[model samples]
Target: MFDWTRSCAYDEQQKRRFHTTARSRLKKLAAELALPPGSYDVRSNKAGVAVSGEVTLHHTAVYIQVGQFGMSSGHGILIRTCKGRKNYTGGANHFVALSMLDDIPALAAAVRAITGVGRADADSADRRAA
Candidate 1:
């Protein structure tokens, strides 16, 4: 038997872990944006793999892609949402490359600009939904 129960449990654990990691990464962002962490929803398609996985922020309407950095092969995060993609390293509007877990103040600001939705508004909407 493949033990689907165990597999499901493992998958859920991985998802939770990824969400936790995402929460940690977004903690400061939530503060800066004045958005509540509970209002942010996270989903991963790569079994919540720490590297090369896709994590989508559904409620916040953001996508986080983490994997090998360009040219350097170092780990980094690439945010994909709205119209274009933001690489780990690129122009001023581009994402920042990370050899490790780097804070995302700039990225969050970029997201704010791209989404054109303020945290206060998002927070209000989330509260209304709740």
Candidate 2:
């Protein structure tokens, strides 16, 4: 004797668990991408902490900024190719909520395109483009 209602409940629980696990994994990946294997500087600002680093994408050097919010619980990262851009001034233009870690790769690719750093790795960029 199979109970349809009970099966539906089980499916809902499984979906919830899968979502939770996926979110956690995405956050971990975001942290890893936030810091590459290189030297970076951390500076404090009134709003949050800013991380300045250099990233080489497609053999082009670009300046990166990863900002961690101090006043708020959430954090953000901004990667740019140009230095002293008014858009990123005070960390306004190139901002992505840390809570949306799952979409970080897409965001990064978009930034790279805007900064004219050449397209990112085909496979990696494909996922976001799709």
Clashes per prediction?
2, 0
> Which predicted model would earn the best lDDT?
1
Report the C-alpha lDDT of model 1 over 14-59, residue by residue, as the tens digit: 5455445654565555465565566555445554343334444443
Judged by whole-model lDDT over C-alpha atoms, candidate 2 comes out at 0.38
lDDT by residue (2-117, candidate 2, tens digit) is: 12111112354533443343334334433444534332332223221122121112112344443233215343444445443222333224554434434555655555565554
For the record, the alpha-carbon RMSD of candidate 1 to the native fold, in angstroms, is 11.0
Q: Candidate 1's C-alpha lDDT? A: 0.46
* Residue 125 lDDT, candidate 1, scale 0-100: 64
Task: State candidate 1's TM-score.
Answer: 0.42
> Candidate 2, 11: how far from true, in Å?
37
